[model samples]
Target chain A: MPPAASPVPCKPLFFDLALNHIGFPSLDHKLPVKGAEAASPASAGEANKPDQPGGLSGLVKGLWGWGSKK
Target chain B: MAHNIKNVRIQAAYAELKKLIDQGSYSRIIKTTNKIVNDDQSQPEAWQCKVVAYIQLDQFKEAINAINKAPNRQQMQFELAYSQYRLNKVAAAIDTLDSAPDKDSPRGKELRAQILYRLEQHSECYTVYRELLRTTADDMDMERTTNMAAVQVHRVELGQCPVPS
Candidate 1:
């Protein structure tokens, strides 16, 4: 009698580490409003003050003034 | 609003699916993805997740079916070919790959090389592996090098020169 044929061993195939490669979609979420931090009480008070500029300009002015004083 | 509620439901479903995937829960992923797709048949991500889960479970036919229903089938050509390859439909896999827009991608090339190796086209397989090695980073060279060595071994077994001239 003839012997039964055995199955061949298949080599391992390399796959991407992440599901993103398989077309899995990312979570869709809304971005926070820009300058939302300015709404904080401390920052709002600082912004409302007559002399202080708001946000980036305020930070830059503070830095420049500090440098000039030195 | 109704729109907000729907968005929240979809978000929660996706979050659960992500958690299931991280846990390697293939069955749960299939169940969850099925529910998601039932609620919204146009959810390409749900179809994609179901296909991947089916493949992981060695259910290639089911994977292929899920892929057929996906809205973004064109973008999932590699995955379709992969499932076909797992099913031992090598020629079909190759045909599917030939139609892929990103056939030149590293993953696509790697899969093509594997199918060529299975078909015993060693020289073609070697050329693909060489191309991959040339582009692969040093840290990721181990697997490609191993595959290249296997090709050389097969060549030697066939009484040909181990290394290509």
Candidate 2:
């Protein structure tokens, strides 16, 4: 009986080599976390804020606040 | 941290394998693929598809393995291509992607994106999602937009639901 060829070495999984297709830099380090930074409005500042979800009470406060500003 | 370290080790090894292949140490790829084939259960749709991909430059070998290890006759090419893509066989992936059937194209990208996403490669998924939106979408822009928004809300990676605007 012929000897089976030594099962070749297990190759690496090469995770980020696939990312080369998408043009992300640093294949070995640093993936951008989605929405982590943009989730908080305070750091990004008030003028840049998109509408936030507020209950009816907050809406009343907002209206009053708007009147006070004028 | 052990599992994370192990994962990093595996990734590094694969990168080395890819580097060897790129450096014209091509014979190692065959040996490497053989190893993967043996360590694995030869289960269809498992990572065995990747082994088949490295043989693309050799049509007969690639075709044979692809036919044998493929999940199905239909999905074989894309599966193989996805594997090669992982191994940094970029040209091979593009070739496989191109030769595959039109119906298979979306499936191919989805599978590739899926593999990447599982590895925590969300950026690639985002790229593929944008490309898929091109072919899968139609004149109904508003509807597609609404549907995708809902899909994002659902956070289901594989679902291709079209939301109503």
Grade the docking of candidate 1.
incorrect
Candidate number achieving the greatest TM-score relative to the actual structure: 1
Interface RMSD for candidate 2 relative to the native interface:
15.0
TM-score of chain A of each: 0.26, 0.25
Each prediction's DockQ against the real complex: 0.11, 0.02
Q: Tens digits of per-residue lDDT for model 2 on B51-160?
A: 33344344444544645554454545554556555565656666766676742455666555545444444455556656767876544435434433433433434343
lDDT of 1 by residue, B30-109 (tens): 99888777777888778878888887788989889888888978878888988888778999989999999989987788
| Residue B120 miss distance in model 2 (angstroms) | 46
Residues A1-60 of candidate 2: C-alpha lDDT, one tens digit per residue = 999878763322322322222211122321122234446676566535346666887688
Give per-model TM-scores. 0.69, 0.27
Native contact recovery (fnat) for each candidate is 0.16, 0.00
lDDT of 1 at B90: 91
Q: Return the lDDT, model 1, position A49.
A: 78
